[model samples]
Target chain A: MASKPPVTPAFSLAIDAMGGDAAPEVVLDGLELAAERHPEGRFLLLGDEARVGAALARRKRAARICSVRHAPDTIPGDMKPTAALRIRGSSMRLAIDAVAAGEAAGVVSAGNTGALMALAKIVLKTLPELDRPALAAIGPSARGDVVMLDLGANVQCDARNLVEFAVMGDAFARAVLGLTTPSIGLLNVGSEELKGDDRVRAAAETLRDSHLGANFRGFIEGHDITAGTVDVVVTDGFTGNVALKTGEGALKLMRDLLRQVFTSSVPARLGYLLARPALDRLREWMDPRRYNGAILIGLRGVVVKSHGGTDALGFAHAVDVAMDMVTHGFNESIRDGMAKLATQSRALPV
Target chain B: MASKPPVTPAFSLAIDAMGGDAAPEVVLDGLELAAERHPEGRFLLLGDEARVGAALARRKRAARICSVRHAPDTIPGDMKPTAALRIRGSSMRLAIDAVAAGEAAGVVSAGNTGALMALAKIVLKTLPELDRPALAAIGPSARGDVVMLDLGANVQCDARNLVEFAVMGDAFARAVLGLTTPSIGLLNVGSEELKGDDRVRAAAETLRDSHLGANFRGFIEGHDITAGTVDVVVTDGFTGNVALKTGEGALKLMRDLLRQVFTSSVPARLGYLLARPALDRLREWMDPRRYNGAILIGLRGVVVKSHGGTDALGFAHAVDVAMDMVTHGFNESIRDGMAKLATQSRALPV
Candidate 1:
């Protein structure tokens, strides 16, 4: 059973200041940046008061509307979600608690993804219209930035789940990416209509006939992701996770190979110095920091997970994503989209 | 019904001369390279006799060991596999025909992948011990070269199919990659035993207790593919295909970005000139031609597919791969492994 979540005035956000690899500093610095953009927003900072309070006081803007909550414990990055869930004193859990308790509209964390997801689900519960919450993130493509969903949420999803993902992703793009109408594509082995399994085929059929049919671009292959064949790429958790990791791995490999090439000889080392500026520009364009936020959509409260290893800028980008989801009524949009989808499913044997 | 392919003297290979984007030129030039390596090798060239014969006559070494089959019709690269199967006069079909007629031990083609797979399956059939034939390829990783299988072969694989893939991948690693005892990992969303679909979990269970259990590394996540945590990464075709394409796409994206940076300014251009030699070495190490061969594993006959977009050097690598498989008695090894797997399954309730 799935239903849309109630619309909430998500003006305040809870922060897990002890989350990320950089921890309290990244959170404090990120909040300062976020505060500059959302002057009216309030933040409930969860972590050690002594640590975050000293840092928060230094950031004028972040300190103005932020309140530091005493959370003595910090969840280890490698800690299992089940173990983390039992530790209520952890900053991650405390931050999520703020959202559940209506102190904040959403919670942002740069901690263990598994623990975050598990804790968020148990506390916030899923939206009325979702069987499970999905993780959605933005990635660069040849054309532009593209939105991909179900990064590692549900390992197994039926056709219905895919259709639901398309709805959530469309709303997400509209909100964060600011696309008026984003083209949707179902990731598969081939772009041909006859290709893929029954679940993928069925999902394609539903999307094609649904209200979002105008933006549905049918099947797309792996290369199509970077090719930017569509604005939103949707697939089950397993394939999506593998694809994401594989893409990351390839990029790292090339980066390493490039590094090796640049340091191989004295001539090459000099060449690297000359090429530093242009390469820096290229690096900025492809920076993982710019796309650090991964939203857990379809949850009762907004949840954005930042990369655990990211610095202040990356954590700030994640904050921006969460704020956008809250301010733009991202959940409400999903509700409306899902309502239409439900009507369509009822009208046809989808 | 799965049975081992009959062992034959595989000293000769059939060549689809007019297959690649460069057609007879890449084929003939590639044969010249293969001939240099295998002096006793025989090649039956299938293409327009005048074109292939004229080119063959120019290459002294290739001319000595090659026989032109006069296959005038060249299959279009974009032609459907079903359509290709009906075209008996086509060069791609003729090459397979020579292998079927026992004139050649195996067939190599840089033709339409779908057409080749379809035609090969229809003519040669699956091995006695397998439910389906899989496509396997080698790719670079952090540690070294790694083998991944079922790359768009079976979209929906069961537990049995996954287990079978492990056996085939193990044999492939030993035969083509020349690994003594390759560590195999089942591609999953997470490495935890509790994660993934039932089929994946079941496959992991069987592999954990099989004869290859010592080398079986349980489950591996997507990043592990590039991290080289295992020697062979095995998964269903759909996921494998997507992961491979994603990795390729990422690499291409980085390459394009690097090119843009290199040409951005006068200084960058000068730097590129200085770095050209070292960059060239890096390019050679990561060349597509070096890893051009994608074998159609579990087939009754040795069939290797080359990238249609590749050049002569790449095509030669495919020939080299086919020759290696033949020399190593790959299919026989798979049979022996499967036989042990069968006995183990019989002994236990796998």
Candidate 2:
């Protein structure tokens, strides 16, 4: 009865149905739209069953498209993700667990980041000796798209963690960006070896000694984020968070400034109308929705993260990102690749 | 036949002859412009006899214009400021020493920051028992300018240091922004009381209990910097430097992006041409030249710190800022008013 799925294996996504600032409606809208596009893709919707079911029933999506799984509680954004992992009933934990247990191919959430990270770590666990999992965002760059990581996974990290991050980041880039070997850069205060704090200097030394160091392209500064000079930008959570927020704030400020300038006078407003098409094209390129979702890397299974304030369109893009990772065998590839490194090099610190 | 300086007892400003990337060219240009505007103002040029003398010889200004002092050595930018301070022949140190000895009303430098701070601190010393001086910049806000301190003075600061910064920032806003009792805000990871690290949270409590507590505006986040939500944003040197750099990088990125969009197509270029006047006005308003220099506060003598990369226009504006502070007696006013607080405050940890 239903048309064949866009792809064969029928990607299964575990959605945190109650997550995000405008959940349920937007989540349902995103799900219905994606279901319509893929027809055969299976989905496991995790949240309060009654409400999720009610929302889905109104959508008129295919009956076999999605199944409901109850997760009675939700993770509050303020709680530290590490602490929230211990609480059993959290929706984020249940969603990630579904993917880890093979009940679903991927997990998607727009919940409290700390809680999602904690849950993913506990349920899926780190790959081999990876001490910490990192959060990565795939955003628009001057070179089309680039990955930035450790956005806020762990606040403080040593050189070993950075070395591992470079490895994981490279693996993710291979899976997502499709680069054979992604060029990785360690983010610091400046490009010079003498720049940044103690952690950065030590990280640079460790990176220079590793086999992974071949693909590691020197240090990059805060301004280098959107510059598109490298495939991946690596930094500890604190600096990364500050940089991320600063970028977000800048985009918004520029948009406001542009709008004010466009509408300042009658002639300018007429010019805006005449140039609306080109401006809109430019806006689409810079829109957050086009690149909102990020993947929580260094986990046992695929887990995509949508921003807390994402709308239906953004959520739909996150679903597509998860589907892509599943089809690409992202997790298995990382595990197999890292395993070879572990056997060949005992020099890499745990 | 030099005319007598207008009858301002506590106010005068000495210009550095060998400061900034462009050196005497930009500095002298600024001096000439300011001299024309304030015909009764006085300036002392500090540098080598040949250069300063030659530059002065070229200027045919009002009689109250200039004086010159010779120095045997110059401090290059790459060397550490402290090391440069140890050299007695360095022009920057000599100019700062003039201010300390009350031979000049103020000293302004666009030279190496670390060097100027070191020389100023050593020669002028802190007000009484105050251990370290803070560099303060006036961040432009919608309501007015926010007094932000320790732009890069102290890197590692404690809870007590932040509290003192808030107090000093409040006093600064009162004197500069012309608020009788200005609002103070602590820069934090979030607006909540429990949001920041141990130091920030503890400092918030201390701020609440201090005499400056009545007008304290609580915690403000990074986005608040451009949002103009607070009259004062106080933080230690590390975070402040990060914020300042982020803003600078973001501003540059936006300008570049606008240029790219405008030149992408003929239609867009035409639109940009039509909107040029309004956009140009906005650019002028946001220009760094208009907000040229920072005052190194809490020292016994007034010192203005200019940006290292400043051009002729920026240099000119720095001169204007220096003139304003000198004429307004900024140092003596704050020192005499906060003498009690300065004496009672605990000395900085060495």
Candidate 3:
């Protein structure tokens, strides 16, 4: 088992209160829930003072643990990542800045994903020896939760970039999912070694010969993602993004089809009521809110991006991920893993 | 509506009778079903004479319409495409050769995808002005069926390749799905034109300015596949293959979860009985057999590859697709579309 990091009470997380669809209200509600879940956790809430102050008025318990800072502007959902970088007074930027300034251990936002990635990359920068940061998220699988990475952080990636993603994904599964030594697999069209593009083949070869080869499962197909064939699924951003969305689309289609089936007749409606408890359990198990957070890994500090359309519960889950990262010292583990990889790559007879 | 090709009785489809998991038996059963569906359709069955003759004896109806040929060899599923290319007496190769020799309009096989592609490419070759063939399949969607390609035909595709895929996918959707001016969307990480890699962006630009621009729907995310946001989704083989398999995985996962939900308690069990009819309908709607065939588009002749593990019903659906392609003159439509694209591309300012 990987050694657990020391529990630290000094870690605080920054929240972009005016980020998601519901904005300050959803953020405050989520903060209250998170605060209740983790009594020792502290929060720095950045947003319009009046709006945040009004929302906080109802959550005295959460307000006691959160310190609010006034930010005059907001980053629009449609704003490009480059344009978002110039908005200094925006709540999203200010919240991320808190982490960069060491006022907080991590940052959580439900803002535009591209903007969040850009601002976090600029503010916290990447870890030493890492060329780019990857967005990692946990997805529900048949056996358990699966960690997948590079979910649109870098559109096009090379062999070395994929290797880096594998390392970061491995550390992430260990840190957040509490896996001891997670099996990692490079996502490809087929499990066969000769089935994919040149970049994938080279990355697979590197992983096979690396020190982490014992835990590396080689190439895994798309079905393997939900089959829980591997603990960590690493791929380039474009493919990862598409796979993630495609899975989401399939689940949505299933839900819609089920709804249609149950509402088709009176007997089906009765069955729905009778099976309500079991169906509810199934729904909760597959709830998007339960798997809400997507972390920008390889960053100097932890940054979590929640789905912009998600509600309070989803935002709270994002906070849980951020807290887990900060408490577990995710970045430290990644640094150690990278150092080991660097040595292993150099030790190879060139 | 797109003009339907004149239905000609001269169209006969060739079957690789020694392919699939339950070869000869499943092939005969599927042929029986297809013969009943298309009373006027003729079939050329190619396989080992003894085995195929034995299966054909029990399938009198299919045997009446099929003319059996003695192909002594069978291509093993694990054989490489290149190795399979040299086996001239193999059932798979013979079935494809029948199309080249003008004995059949198209060929259908539930065999090794790689070998089928390679053999078909060698025998039937590619259509004029088309560099490579692509695998195109129809997937169930919220609005109906959506045509997507290339499902592992080319691992790495350039901007020109993507544009070609868009053209082929557009034609396939129109021919098989019976859509007039089917809207086309290039699969990407984001819906924005500037969001994806150079190839995707370049393809989008070409599609936007070409003769097919009016029917082009711009970039679509993975979720858009099942959402039925567009009629045709064009992508590189690697991405398309991953997306297709990911979707299949998600559907299987949903089915497993539903089974657990419906059998958890006595009430749920009773609910299952009450909802059986509706659930059955839902199952029929999403049945794999209903959308079995995946056509290798851009080839000189139509070639359909069924899932190797699928049963007789699935194989029948594959034959159904081949029959549709032949009767609808799918290749002719593709040739016309490519000619139009070539003319438009030449007229553009370099």
- Please, what are the lDDT tens digits per residue for candidate 2 over residues A1-350? 00122233333888898888877778888888778766767988888889888888888773359888898888777778667877687677788777766677778988886677667877887766477788888866666677877776765567777767777787788777788878889876557786566666777776666666787778876666677778988877655655666566656666777788888998788667666777787788878897878788877677888888888888888887787777676766666655655665445543
> Candidate 2: which docking quality band?
acceptable
Worst 10 residues of 3 chain B by lDDT: B1-10
Between prediction 1 and prediction 2, which has the larger lDDT? 1
TM-score of model 2 vs. true structure: 0.85
Each prediction's DockQ against the real complex:
0.82, 0.32, 0.82
Q: For model 1, what is the error of residue A159's alpha carbon versus the real structure, in angstroms, after optimal superposition?
A: 0.7
The local lDDT score (0 to 100) that residue A318 gets in candidate 3 is 96
| Residue A15 displacement in candidate 3 (angstroms) | 1.3
- Please report how far candidate 1 places residue A276 from its true position, in Å: 0.4
By DockQ, the better pick of 1 and 2 is 1
lDDT of 1 by residue, A78-176 (tens): 998889999989999999988887768899999998899999999999888767789888998888999998998988888888989999999999999
Model 1 C-alpha lDDT per residue in residues B240-273, reported as the tens digit of each score:
9999999998888888888989999999999999
Better model by lDDT: candidate 2 vs candidate 3: 3
RMSD in Å for all candidates: 2.5, 5.6, 3.5
TM-score of chain B of each: 0.95, 0.88, 0.94
Give the poorly placed runs of model 3, Cα more than 4 Å off: A1-11, A345-350, B1-11, B345-350
Inter-residue clash pairs, candidate 2: A81-A114, A81-A115, B81-B115
